[model samples]
Target: MTDMPLGAPGQRSVLRSLWQTQRVWLASATILAALAVFDPLQAAESAVFAVGALLNTAPFLILSIAIAAWAGATGADNLIAKAFSGTPLLMIGLGALAGGISPFCSCGVIPLIAALLAMGVPLSAVMAFWLASPIMDPSMFVLTAGVLDLEFAVAKTLAAIGLGLFGGTVVHLMMKGGAFADPLREGVGNGGCGGAKMRAPRPVVWRFWADADRRAKFGKTALSTTLFLAKWLMLAFVLESLMLAWIPAETITEMLGGDGLVPIATATLVGVPAYLNGYAALPLVGGLIEQGMAPGAGLAFLVAGGVTSIPAAMAVWALAKREVFAVYIGLSLSGAFASGLLFQLWTSMT
Candidate 1:
């Protein structure tokens, strides 16, 4: 009997990989396709809206990508690695501040985290960086300001740093009581590509074009960042259109609207399962607020979803013990709720 061709299995594996890698794009296309078949007018209107939205945000998107690419080429993250050598309290403070404002992209932060943990960095400082880094970066701030508002962007930035400080402090106290000793998982010391750079960061070379290699690196980062932002935003805008069309305003107002901590609490819980990405979450939050969800609720949702998102949690699991991961999640949830509560009070006073 003739054996089945081995190429068939290889082709199937290739297709599977493509599907996994491109799920976001595929989901966006699928939504459009379904809408086109069921309601042609709605599909056309959504397409227009998504395209228009992207065009409006184009300037901010360009600036955001430039900042990220520039930071990458100039070795800003190397500076980040070097900052981890101070006292726990000092390091925690630095961690929170640097993470919130750092131009380093999210892609590098994971490896950086791995490297720090591997190098025997204190869990408290690492937790501070870990919580804050994913919450807000330069790119996130620009996109939030563009899609939401300056006030919301500013609030989110504060929330990021605040959450970091809170988590770090808690972890520091717990560790003082002898909790979370030797937290790293087995077989995880290397920082991968990004980690290596952080471990022994080269000095910043701002005039990247002066060197051929740096010029190439700059170009690559720019192109990749642009594509990364573009795809997520497109999917987010499209989903926003669908949400606006289908989800009733009254339902949103009733569940996630109004004064009090109830809406904020509700939003924090909802954010965990609903959040697909930081980039995608902004438009949805904007859409939710447009439907009358409170501003504080939006902040809570953004913070909660960002820290507990699947990818973020998985990264923690990859490097730390189960207990440490649990602590991380616990801190994220509590901090998110508190942020929402505080921001709600602020908005009311203002």
Candidate 2:
């Protein structure tokens, strides 16, 4: 037989690398196994619930990823940068609006930021998008509406835009005041830890499949996106099941059910650290609401968690200096509280 090609060694090396990098999945699997051995019924229920949740959200997730990938491939970002080029105030509003609709999480927004900065986009407009992008997206909006209600969904969208505008305006004023001078550190565009600037593929519309490279890229991106989302969602569903099974509704209601600034503030504080992915947070928040958590408090939790969650904060830390990161966090917390209060008042009136 012909000597075995060197491919086996290369394949083995690739397998080893994949195994090493899949620690999260390995840990999750171990925990699930342990749970099954110790409590089969609970484990089974959690598994079923996780699968159901995944299935329910898969369509929205697919749509969001497709749109994002298409935008990235079509050089739409260049157009976006041009739109906000000269008009600072309009940029704030439009940036916030764009961020709310775009299906980018905090981490996902970083590369886009890198691209915009590389192309000489204004920091003020970028700040607005950065502040709002994590809060919600089209897919997230649909998911939220399904879990909560149309009113809640609409309010959350507004909150996202409102927060973005607030951040953008503050940054613009600060820029005028000589703060944020040379905001980008040297080598940001070099694609170090900050993230690589998104490169626009050759323009292609419905004929994306006509290009072999584009087809491969689309497939890879879609798979990666699905896997990334599935991991968090699986964990979330498991946690949600456990909460429903063990935690008393009375506890959730007592803690987060009250109206007023106190509850809103409490929610904000609780949310900042405890928050996970937006899609993951949905079922948990829904459970809280069902347990009589105040709608306003729930909203506060979502907004706060969306903005200041560990992943989102990490992205900010990677991109900005310590001082700018601090302001971002502060603005997020304050905006969450204010939005919560407004929502509470509105709900009470209506």
Candidate 3:
């Protein structure tokens, strides 16, 4: 028999390396097996929590990933790259508008923004999207509506959009006449480039839902995707569940009992670092309001916590230059304060 080709041997070696390195599969399998051995009631409760967490992030994760992959494949990032061709002032306006429409949260936007920056999108526009997208999106508006009064929702939404716009504008102004800071450092490969060479058209999120692939084979795709995305999602759930179980709703209310700048600032400061998802954030905000926190302050905290995420910021730092990353941090902090202050004033005046 002819000796095996070098290329085939090399491919197998690479595959083996990947299999050994990526522990996500192993961890997932272990957790699942452990769950299976638990008492019936405990197993059921864990299962329910797992399912809920899976469902909560699945919609956004799948859609965002699909959009990102498609955008990468089609060179749509170059379209983003085009934003840099314009004056900083113009790009800032464009960034503000894009931020207003994209409903993906701070974390969800990372992959998208990274892709845009990697493709050469203007720093001003990329930063704009980073600052604004979470605030003005439809889902946020829906949450605001359901969690607070309609007037409060409208005011919150406007303040969020304004923060994004203003932050972008300020950064652009500050960086004006400066050299462009390169965002993408290393050469990161585009979606699907690592595994296969197929040029098939990118499918919609729903299509990925129905189609068979490495993931969908035997319904394992759903399982793998859930496992891949579950780590951070778990943080949100565990914290929220604990807060629900141990922290009296009354305690939250008592702490925030005042409609003033101090209360709003305090809430915003506390929230910016917490990294709570909507489920957790809503209850906390509602509890504070029930305790007498100004509606605007509660709104501000929610907006800040949801939008200004440290984890996401770290990713931005890894992907972009120090200067741009610094700008991002400053803008996020300023925007959070602005949103908090505006909401506080509006609440006090009304």
Give the number of the best model, judged by TM-score: 3
Model 1 lDDT tens row, 1-350: 87657678877898799897787688789999999999999999889988987786676466655655666667664554566666878989988998888754433455456546644567789899889987898888999999999999999999999999999999999989988767776645433222222345467887888988888887986776566555666776787676556655445445666657888999888776566568877887888788777888999988998888755665676557888899999999899999999998898899
Please give the range of 10 consecutive residues that has the lowest summed lDDT in model 3: 189-198
Per-residue lDDT for 55-101 in model 2, tens only?
76565566666755554455464565566676789977888888888
- Rate residue 197 of model 2 by lDDT: 34
* Candidate with more favorable, higher lDDT: 2 or 3: 2
Which 10-residue window of candidate 2 scores lowest in summed lDDT?
Answer: 190-199
Each candidate's number of clashing pairs is 0, 0, 2
Per-residue lDDT of candidate 3, residues 1-350 (tens digit): 87667669777897788766554345444554565685445445544765686576567777765555555444354454554667866777777777777667654665566556555555566677777776657776787678766776687667666776787777666656664444454433222122112223333243333444522432442333334345544444433433344455555555556866677766666565553555456767776777667776777676676565543554455455666667766766667767778767666676
Question: Where does the lowest 10-residue lDDT sum fall in candidate 1?
Answer: 189-198
Score residue 325 of candidate 2 by CA lDDT: 83
| Runs off by more than 4 Å, candidate 1 | 1-83, 104-107, 190-255
Whole-model lDDT values for every prediction: 0.76, 0.73, 0.59
Model 3, CA-based lDDT: 0.59
TM-score of each: 0.61, 0.63, 0.66
